[model samples]
Target: MTANAADKSLQAEVNALPWFHQIDFGNGVLSPGWIKKSKVERVSRTLFDPLNVTGKTVLDIGCWDGAYSVEATRRGARRVLATDHFAWSEQCWGDRRSFELTRQHLAPSIEVMDIDVPNLSTTTVGTHDIVLFLGVFYHLRHPFETLERVAAMATECLVLETHLMRLPFTTEPHMRFYPNDELHNDHTNWWSPNRACVEAMLRDVGFKRITMKHPDYRRRRGIFHAWR
Candidate 1:
């Protein structure tokens, strides 16, 4: 087949799926994903540094489209594991095609698992130096318990990003429950915890040092880097 034909075929396959992460395929052919958020620019530089993953084992929970999984591997991580079940399964607006394609096209050596958050443990997925728990906290039914499970497998650090429920003058940790799609018209979204709530919860879950930063306050998206 000609190069143009191969590109057309790849484009047809990419356009057919629901994509959450924008992945770059070579020859200037990029996946036409819905999310324009540059995980490399916005996420890698500010919230958490990908350069820090050099020679470390990394795990990315809810690794939609394997963006960070590929990034971690590119930054020289010893081993990279990506996991997801809800978005990859038939219950959501996404599938594993994007991740699989991205992995195949970019970082083929990274491992993947179709596992849920509650099932994460040292024994199940083994421990890692860095664990990324981004965009999955609010969607979970058991938030605190889920963090504890995530922490159990972290040997060095855990970086988490989630929707923050900002309540001014509230020093104590608190969470707002979303019943019947009160937040975004998505039934999967269950809770939005304030920044204080997330930091406190991370400390409670055995992370000795916790740092919180907000990429966009108006968007209510906060990032946390917790160290063991």
Candidate 2:
């Protein structure tokens, strides 16, 4: 088939949708996503090394626009499952159109689901060699329960990224709760835990090995690698 009117129509459809991740859709076209920072820039290269997952099953929780999902496939993961609920719900500025379109263009074999974190289990989503739980932890109302649930499905490793709080004088397990839209003017932003607290939670949930990948004190963000 030749590139014609149908192709242009499809490209137009993709451009019209609201995107969160900067997804490139070939032929010099790019989805003008809202997020300023690139996923690769935030996650970084060294972080991707320990979570190599070559020929291993990979799961990307809260996979908005399937950026990491496509990255996992690029790393030669045997199977990549991208799961999302909030962003894909088609409300607010989020919709599954970007993810669906991105997957169609890149990493066509990637599987996607609209499952929440609490419902994740061996029976529901099966087990994965590696799970990417990036930028979703603080949003959970039941942090412990959700972390435990995610831990159960990971056979090898879980790479996590979330907001952190630095007390400056104390190294205690503390988490600031936002009952309203106090955090970044968004109501979905619920909890912000300190670095020690995050590590403790991972240990409590049955991770044998825990490593802090990136701890940005200036930005107040943390990246942790937990091994099952």
By TM-score, the best candidate is 1
Stretches off by above 4 angstroms in model 2 are 1-11, 37-39, 42-46, 215-218
Q: What is the TM-score of each candidate against the true structure?
A: 0.93, 0.90
Alpha-carbon lDDT, every model: 0.85, 0.83
Cα deviation in Å at residue 198, candidate 2? 0.4
lDDT of 2 by residue, 75-150 (tens): 8999999999888775556888789988998899999999877788778888899988888998999988888888
Cα displacement (Å) at residue 167, model 2: 1.7
Report the Cα lDDT for candidate 1. 0.85
Candidate 1 stretches greater than 4 Å from native? 37-40, 216-219
Query: Candidate 1 lDDT, tens digit per residue, 1-228?
Result: 999989888877878877888777766677777655465447766544623778999999999898878878888899999999999887887889889888987999999999988788888899999998889999999988888988888889999989989799979989999888888898989999998898889999998988777765345888889998
**TM-score: model 1 vs. ground truth:** 0.93
lDDT at position 181, candidate 1: 89
For candidate 2, the per-residue lDDT at 36 reads: 38
